[model samples]
Target: MIYLRRMDYTVIVYHLLFHLLLLTLGFSPAFCFFSSIKNTFKWGVQSVGNAVCSGVNCCDFHLNDNVEENLTKLLKDKLFGQHIAASLLVEALSSHRTHKSQKALGIGLHGWTGTGKNYVSEMIAESLYKQGMRSPLVHVFAGRASFPDGDEVKKYRKDLLTWIRGNVSDCGHTLFIFDECDKWPVGLIDVIKPFLDYHSVIEGVDYRNAIFLFLTNTGGSAIGQRMLDLHEEGVIRDKLKFEDFHDEISLSLFNEEGGFFKSDIIRGDGIDFHIPFLPLEERHVRKCAERQFELKGYSNPTGRMIEDVLKNMLYGPTSNPIFSMTGCKRVHSLVLSVIARLKLEL
Candidate 1:
């Protein structure tokens, strides 16, 4: 046998200790070492077993042809009412992904609370990223939770800009969602106006491949009035089109005291589509209840159970009570309570 040098013995001991440390930490020796190298180099590293996209030159950033089809399927299957919003979203996303866009696609969803605005946003996120909202590139910000005080608008603006710039620099296909836009401090959202503008590049980063979604309830009243008017005029709800409520909703958002109030994004054509979500009727709420039951594994929810769910929901316009006042927002909770009561009785 050949004699080994002291240096060789020391190297063997170090490697053995390193691998033992990896095993102690619950990582496979070979996988841990290669994964560390892959992360450091970030190129030409084939993922080991079941490795997900790390948001660095990964396939998750690439928009595929199936994204439109998948989005359309999800909207049609999962989302309840508001056909106008669904159609507009599908076309807008499809076009933006297929064509060469100059700026990030900015969509403003205006509606009443619990009218599927948040749900639609979630679906959009699911379609774009494999990990859905959990994806590193998909960022969600709620107004009330993110920026609570109006006094700190300046600080919020600085941090918001830095966050946007940094994320866009990392991945051009990032998706930024701002929920409860109505609650966001006025003039605070304009910090992102530059990212949403029609510029090919801002500073050194190109944000054209990104998507910005703004969800707000500021225009609920306007949308409700428009729908009521259309109903009185004998226009079928299914027949309602974008032109019918686009201008009304835009005016409401621009004049409202919330996020978009008197904002430059509204004054200019910064927002690409102001998709309106119509108030859900009783039938839509029933559908929501049915879906909730299906999701809860109660495949055959009885008619009486569904009726109980609807009875608990509040409807609107004390005179006519045409729409669900709270929409399907409380459906999940209501279903859970009903199921619990039924189990107790049984």
Candidate 2:
């Protein structure tokens, strides 16, 4: 009789284990060992995801969502040239980030090298997230550095899509910047077309709530020509308006011979604006020198040093008029060098 009882107990234990296996595989997660544990784990993960997508607990970093206050902060000090572009940037970016809006904000920043294209991009991040390039929402991909020759482009496309989809799913308010896009692999831009599409939200990834900025010197020469044309006609450089170069820039960007030739990002109506960053002249370089000097902890300014800095920089166009080829990009280093020399001379 004791042997019979032992056999019965063994049967009971087997049934219990079988029941648990069914419960876990059929009703709960197949990966979990226990049914109750799986239910609770899945629920917790789903709840967190929901909170993030709904705009709660999305940013680990602090961000100022105010528009006008942010605008004031953007224009208060620093950033010398491109006032019109700055105003447009504040107006557009403020609305895009703060208000509930649809479609990704596609901004094409075009200009000569060192002409504040990258600077403006930095300022945009600073105003929005206060971390500038360090923002969790901002992703910068440079052409040569990112898409080097090889089968890397293939892998990069997969990673890029995954990153965008995953992040946009987590938080709809994401920002992507592609710098020096002129040198991007020939077929790479084509792969990004769908993500830039209006209202393209896949697998709970709402890409419409994101922002995309493309910076390049692809149309710099054309832009220079138009500015030179305006100057020749007696239009003050400061008076150069968006209307003067907007259409020309758009046309140039989409031209077949251009670096971004036939790019859907340029051709498509999805792009919100083509912001032209004008070339910096001597006066603008001086303004940049002043800012750079102040940044170096200089309480006073020197005229001789600033002029020499300007003279050291190379100019271009080699025609009726010329402008700073290096823009204010080299001014900071030049400013510091001149200051050190002057102090030693004194």
Taking all chains together, each candidate's TM-score versus the true structure is 0.85, 0.78
Superposed model 1: Cα runs more than 4 Å off: 1-46, 49-52, 55-65
When summed lDDT is taken over every stretch of 10 residues in candidate 1, the lowest stretch is 43-52
lDDT of candidate 2 over 45-122, digit per residue (tens): 654454443332456333556645765675657666786678778777867766766677888888888888888787
Which residue pairs show backbone clashes in model 2?
Answer: none
lDDT of 1 by residue, 1-346 (tens): 2344566456556655665688789998788677655443442233221233455455454434478888899999988887999999998998898899888999999888989999998889888877788778888999889999999999999999999999889888899999999999988999988888889988899999999999999889999988988888899999999999977887797788988988988887788989999999999999999999999998889999999999999998776689998989999999999999999999
lDDT of 1: 0.86
Give the clash count for model 1: 0
Which structure among the candidates has the greatest lDDT? 1
Error of 2 at 246 (Å): 1.9
